[model samples]
Target: MGRSLDILLFIVCLAIITPTLNANKLESSEYWKEQRPEFDSYWQEKAEIAKQDNHAAYFPDPYAVSGNFTASISEIITLKSSRRNLKGGKGEKCLATNPVDRCWRCDPNWAKNRQKLADCVQGFGRNTRGGKGGPIYVVTDPSDNELLDPKPGTLRHAVTRNGPLWIIFARSMLITLQQELIMTSNKTIDGRGVDVYIANGAGFTIQFVKNIIIHGIKIYNIQVRQGGMIIDSESHFGLRTRSDGDGISIFGSNNIWIDHVSMRNCTDGLIDAIMGSTAITISNSHFTDHNEVMLFGASDSYPEDKIMQITLAFNHFGKRLVQRMPRARFGFIHCVNNDYTHWEMYAIGGSMNPTIISEGNRFIGPENKFIGKDQINAKQITKREYADAKHWSSWQWRSINDEFLNGAFFVNSGPELKNRPFSRKDMIKAKPGSYVGRLTRYSGILVCRVGQPC
Candidate 1:
């Protein structure tokens, strides 16, 4: 009888200790400890450089761009219903649709305060003050069609200028780029009050740069450009390699905010951020008809990508998109309040233990059975591969408050713990999945008149 009592006591102790062990597992991992120091050091160096150059430091105060939502939730819903009935009405007021839009779009004098957009970004890249300290450079010549020596007053010339600059177009223009438009650091290409389209030609390459904002433009129908001698800056001309023709290729850069742009039909990924890039927010944009929409990390084996933290907020993934809304590896991604109207195969797949927190998004699967069935196959393949490697359980992929329509489902895998790997306080609450349509209704390029609200 005494031996039986001792066994019961041991069982009680075991039950109490097991919870403690599980809770401390992530904190005590040697891999995480070793990586923590390197991550801190790299960001510290980048922060110092940003301070020295008087550039916007990455990940500034979250409340810096907070918006006052004047419209109530019921009012927003009624507006959405009214707008849906009208179909193509352009006069609808798009003031308080989302936090990003409400921050700057309500004012009638948006043209006069165009530079105020630099202060209205949220998420990890909130400090991306693109060309705020620089002079405004107006582009008068839309004639870079030859891809030869870019003349003065051209878009190419404005991008290749020496210092920080806010580049604005003189009029509505369709620029058929001759080669990939390589950008420098600290620039804002403001396309408000103009119909600017970069199509039927090359795309953009943002390599080894920082603090850039590309807003209010439409980029589509991009083809591969055989590389040649191109002018990067006024004083520096170099031979560039063949370009892959991504809508916006962000490589080894940081502090970028790409907002209110529309993209489709690129040769490669719509937006590819790789090679240790961090502090990026791709918000208030629209993407459609693209395969491999966004790729966050370069390779699965490159562990340095653990520093890559990007926030994809208030965007719209529209029709005919296949996989990789963003396929991340060894990074953290916050995909919040996006409207995913259609996807062909599957949405949001990754490898090498990336942390993906998908919150309050509306994912409407394809209507046809063929497409929905293909998503199941893709999901199973990813799960089986990761499970076989025995790395699936540790990766933190969570779906919270998401609306899955048309039998769509998110296959989440991770430790089922109350606490997340990252801090939840840093993120703002995303609009509910039901409200995504109203939030992202005005996703694409806006035609802003000088005297009217945009």
Candidate 2:
């Protein structure tokens, strides 16, 4: 009896100490090298590429407004009301309020002209030609029952093909991927007019590739996959380790756009872009019922992530979200025109001298003011040691034209940085936060029939 009691005590003690020990282990570079070797190698490769390309030239001021931009709250409201009444309103052209949405959603024949979405993206990742100028491939099968040899016409087969291709679904599907959907370069997964879903299984992994667009999909109930031999392309079948279970994992890639996606209830993060991924935009998406919603940079120690530039625009950070929308590190993040309805913890957070430009976002704090301490939680170097303070104090985290409701406030930090001056040649201003609801009304995947507006 005494031995059994002792064993129980030992078990309890082990449970208490194991997490702390694991936490310490995770902080070591060696731990990551062994556990996530792919991430480590990818980071190293990106660092080498950054050096060779002198990629510092690509880092633009995230805070700089695009083109000659100007908009008033009343004007945005008027535009939003007009857009809300777009359905069955004859002689009234489709007038999307946001620039990104306006780019593609305006076409009444959007279902037939699906590829037009590749042209509509704005901000940092505007140049992404996702399967543009490529042949269209349709996914006719929905089953993911076979991981080793995915049948032709399956979603798995469509994504694994080499080279540029525009992929569209033949019908609405609920795909539970057997393994991580390893995507190749120059692919566009367009789910317009379809109620396509990825749930109860693995999610997407965009790694070491470029020029991809994932639009109008619902990703939920994602669980980790114990990885194995997975076909990445037609010519390649490689062994993969376990996945982190993100709705979308963007790793060591560039020129990517993820728009109009609705994500929730993932085992890990809803969306995670890590390991020096850059030139990306995540817009017109809705997030709910998740913890650690988004994570941009992988580590604070990896300074090479300074090249990471992402634009988060026109997204709705919706109900029951805890934090990290997103938690950035060592990157240039432009968070604009997002509507934050609820956050248990702070909305945005970062360390490691990341430059975050929050503009025209509406932050509606939770009813419990104590939970929402600060809308923007930035690190202050003054409280740290002299060496750490000097380094962190130089970070440029600024807020402009942001609306804080219900006792919410932004905790600004770092150097006094000015918005880069611009000429009015072709400016575009983000709509006010008051219009966020209307702008992001159709933020998720649409269910449109053929020959109908999507």
Candidate 3:
């Protein structure tokens, strides 16, 4: 029959292509059984018994936690909900709490709660004065009467002359007379801790307007051997006149607060917000000498250009044993926790574009840095070798690196001495000092959790 009709059409095309090739091999074995348990839990978290049973045994890892929050109210200040909130105050004990209380406890009356507090009034923005946890205006230098608005009011006559608000008592008021304290914000200048003495002839100037408040003042001798602070621009070139001494300027303002103030030896920059001073907050505060402490965006009068996030926390930097510090350019700096000690030369000098996160904050002794530009020589700077070792304790074991735990977002709970990977034949058959080139471990004395350098 014609070879059985061509073997019955090759057995009906192998019975219809063998079940469509076994249904594409059972859909690729059910897509690898649905990706094999996420590839065996990502190789069992890169095995080594789950990285030595989750590492981070202290060192400087005092339970590391960086920005935006992962734990750091200073590690729950004693805890009891942080001692029911840590109350303390200024004038008639300003208390009210819901979210009030940050005196760090010792209970000298338990006040604090002007909406929570935040206003040390730095520069100019809009007629100054806003609210939250009120009272904290330390803008000194109005010939020492201790600045209550040394003159100049507008913004509808400053809410009927300090009634739209009120809070001015500049520590014992002693700027002597360099003159220049033109506060045009809603206003508030309480220097509870005192030391607004800009003596040496004159030094003090805050212009324009906004919701201002400058806490705990301490400006020191402004003889002006040079130039220091003059934001949002506008001052004479000749010998720096203080039409009202411009020590804390912040023109074209907006929600400002320069807390716990201390701008030492003052030429400038204990504070300077320059044009467009928007939602700002320079926390803790304690800067040294006076070359530079804080300066963001140069400014072309009221020119803040989208002035974004600015929060330099904790604060404490140094410059007096002699003096000189402060150099700024861009903004967006959230230099966490802060603390940097007697730096002979520089820590973070200049070069602006701004995007500095920094984190944890601590940089102790022995200066000699060059960093970028390929100048990476290091004999010390890992927090000055555990604060000059010999049994160092809790400065958080100097710098610490394992690449800070590669790809770190903070709180990984294990590996991050500096990024641990090594394998170029284990870094050329490692043997010299059993490896120190990548910063393994040495914990303690790192200090500077919050002493502004942003």
**Residues 1-454 of candidate 3: C-alpha lDDT, one tens digit per residue:** 6555655565455345332111111113453454244323323432333223112110121122122121323233324354454333332222211111233212332123232233222211112245333333323324333232223322112222432244443335554542444443445544443344345544444433455566556665554323222221122111222232235655435555665566554444445555434455555566655434455545322223234345554566654412112333333444444555544333442223333334455545433333222222222222221122332231222122212211112111223334434322211211111122111111111111111111
Local accuracy by lDDT, each model: 0.71, 0.72, 0.36
Considering lDDT, which of the candidate structures 1 and 2 is the better prediction for this target?
2
Least accurate stretch of 10 residues (summed lDDT) in model 1?
Answer: 19-28
Estimated TM-score for each candidate: 0.78, 0.81, 0.25
Per-residue error for 79 in candidate 2, Å, reads: 7.2
What lDDT score goes with residue 73 in model 3? 32
Kindly report which residue stretches of model 2 are placed more than 4 angstroms away from their true locations once superposed. Answer: 1-31, 35-95, 369-393, 415-429
Q: What does the lDDT come to for candidate 2?
A: 0.72
Weakest 10 consecutive residues of candidate 2 by summed lDDT: 377-386
Pick the lDDT winner. Answer: 2
lDDT of 2 by residue, 1-454 (tens): 6556655565455445332111222234764665554444544564466443325324454444332122332344455534455442245355455666665665667776778888878667867889987888999888887676789888888887888899988888999888899887889998887789999999998877788999888999888788887877777666677876778988777888999899998877888887677888898899988867888877767787788888888899998776788888878888878898887657887777787877778888666322123223322111211236456666777666777787677766665444445443333454556666776677666655565444
Off by over 4 Å in 3: 1-177, 180-256, 259-334, 337-344, 348-387, 391-393, 397-454
Q: Report the Cα lDDT for residue 100, model 3.
A: 12
